[model samples]
Target: MQDQNSAVTLADAFNQATYIIGGHGSRKVKVLQEALEQVDGETFSDHYGNGSIIDEFQQEMAEVLGKEAAVFFPSGTMAQQIALRIWCDRADVKRVAYHPLAHLEIHEEDGLKELHHIESILLGEANRLITLEDVKSMKQEVACLLLELPQREIGGQLPAYEELESISAYCREHGIKLHLDGARLFEITPYYEKTPAEICRLFDSVYISFYKGIGGIAGAILAGDSDMMQESRVWKRRHGGDLIGLYPYILSSRYYYNERIGKMGRYYEQAKELASLFNACHGIRTIPERPVSNMFHVHFALAASEVEPLLVHMAQEYSTAITSYLNKTGGNSCSFEMSTGDRYDLVPQDKLRDALTWLDGEMKKKRF
Candidate 1:
């Protein structure tokens, strides 16, 4: 149990720590200044997501994702739901196939079903990546398939490149549309050794989140052929996603994408290095053994109660914040996810290894 006196916020823990599992550190003033500097004379957009930075950003994203057009949404939830709805409507089949843990199925609170009237058929086991065999096994008629690259819920697992191609081929042969839930698309390209466009080519529509790997203030892009995106714009307005002015989020997304997009390969390498360090420790291990992307899970042999205090203590003493808390998966094991980015980049490898060693020792001592 954590003492009231020792309580630390996740935000403060992030700021105090020289390293973190996800994202770079930013001061409020610095973030504000960066956003302001990125903007030119014109700041705001005209009515309903038009004529300014929003259109410019959307155009840039469309090019980046290799699509004829792109539409911006305030959230990925709105963007993705609309994308799936489009596919189902086109095929006249109200079902989509995706992993059981895909965001659309678990995280969206049934919005796809209740709001869009689309049914989801979950694919594959909870602990495994979706395979071509699993796709072949689904007997239901699905209008589209949604693939979440790097499968964030299960320690950022991803399908093999050849296997991904096979699954997409199967979808195409069957006349089913493919939509990619590429919220962290930028982070996964390093593993596949492919460009975002190359991977995106396999899908009918791709949705990218601005805030996740790109570190935007907040926004999402749904990109596809012009006809599909044109229809999406209407859905965006209907869903209340078309804002009067979205330049702040657009400008922030543009600035961060430019700054961080080039570094994702390095982040993927760092994740491998960090995972190796964790696996080398006696009492800790990284899930998937080798990281396929910029994220992985660190499992400790300690209970949740025991691990929480250690995290709090680490924050107070070593100025290292591993995570805010640990989740007990089952039995005596607890796991927390680590995502390498600029925060981890700021700290030396030797220093981070030392922190891992100390954490290992604490977990061992507590277990005995």
Candidate 2:
């Protein structure tokens, strides 16, 4: 087995592979250049979030989300924090509920607690989706309930449509505002067989990321009723989220969102196909076994130390990179997340098949 430090070397080699089977594409300068290629600098302008470019995009997103209004934020962290604050203030409660692994709970370094002074009530176990039973059994009152569609941490799994509706109805009956942490909202539409607006209507407010599935530079849209939007505008300014000119992020968001929103179903199908290939291997399996969105987690019954060298060899010899790194998940097991996108379609089928065949044979050898 390779030393612990060898994972870094393997990752570096993986990045240099001719083909990578994840994400929209490489994050090179050309990505920005391509997004702005047709955008005319002179025609669009915004000052502190109040111009045609920003206004029109906000309106379009509001319509898409079935909300009365939408406000663009520099980051989903800021937007979601402010959203919970608004709900808490309205209900005169300082607590919000969400999955144990919601982005704000795990990734934000307690910004929601420190910046917004809002307490979080973790809803479900760390390893599974939050069920309607979890919401019904909340021991304390919370001003808002947040649900992340296709929970990212647990292999992009989603609750069934009926379960979601039941949760939404219960929240409404209890006067608890439901907000969607829909950073990858567009990516899950194919599985639910519902439009974005249909899903957004279940929640009181919805937040969508432009960078995640849309492949934008960076930005998010917070959509809700007119009253909530007006309040959010105030909070956005207070948080310094309103920039003098956000045309770069705005234009790229609009460009890529329009370009890729219709292709979510294609990405979804690609994800299932790829996950099946991974599952066919001797000791590898995807988290959900079947994807509910464009993304899923791949687990190997071998330690990171055992997998890194093999992945490096695959990249070097097959010119196809499956993943760059793995996270050790206790004794003799490791995992990594995969999200299908434009690059998945770009990989040569014959090369991908041969690479996986080699991987399966090697994994069997290691296990035995």
User: Candidate 2 on 1-368: residue-level lDDT in tens?
Assistant: 23334544677877889999999987787878998888776785789989999999999999999999999999999999999999999999999999999999889999999888899999989999999999999999999999999899999999999999999999999999999999999999999999999999899999999988888889999999999999998999989898898888888899999999998999999999999999999999999999999999999999998888889888878889988789999889999999998888889999999999999999999985
What lDDT, from 0 to 1, does candidate 1 have? Answer: 0.83
**Pairs of residues at least 3 apart in sequence or in different chains that clash in candidate 2:** none
Best candidate (score: lDDT): 2
lDDT of 1 by residue, 62-115 (tens): 888999899888999999999999899988999998999999878889999899
Residue 32 in candidate 2, Cα distance off native in Å:
1.3
Looking at model 1, residue 114 earns an lDDT score of 93
Q: How many residue pairs clash in each candidate?
A: 1, 0
The reply for model 1, stretches above 4 Å from the true place, is 1-15, 18-21, 26-32, 43-46
Instruction: Estimate the Cα RMSD of every predicted model relative to the unseen true structure.
Output: 2.4, 1.9
Worst 10 residues of 2 by lDDT: 1-10
Where model 2 places Cα greater than 4 Å from the true spot, the runs are 1-8
Error of 2 at 316 (Å): 0.4
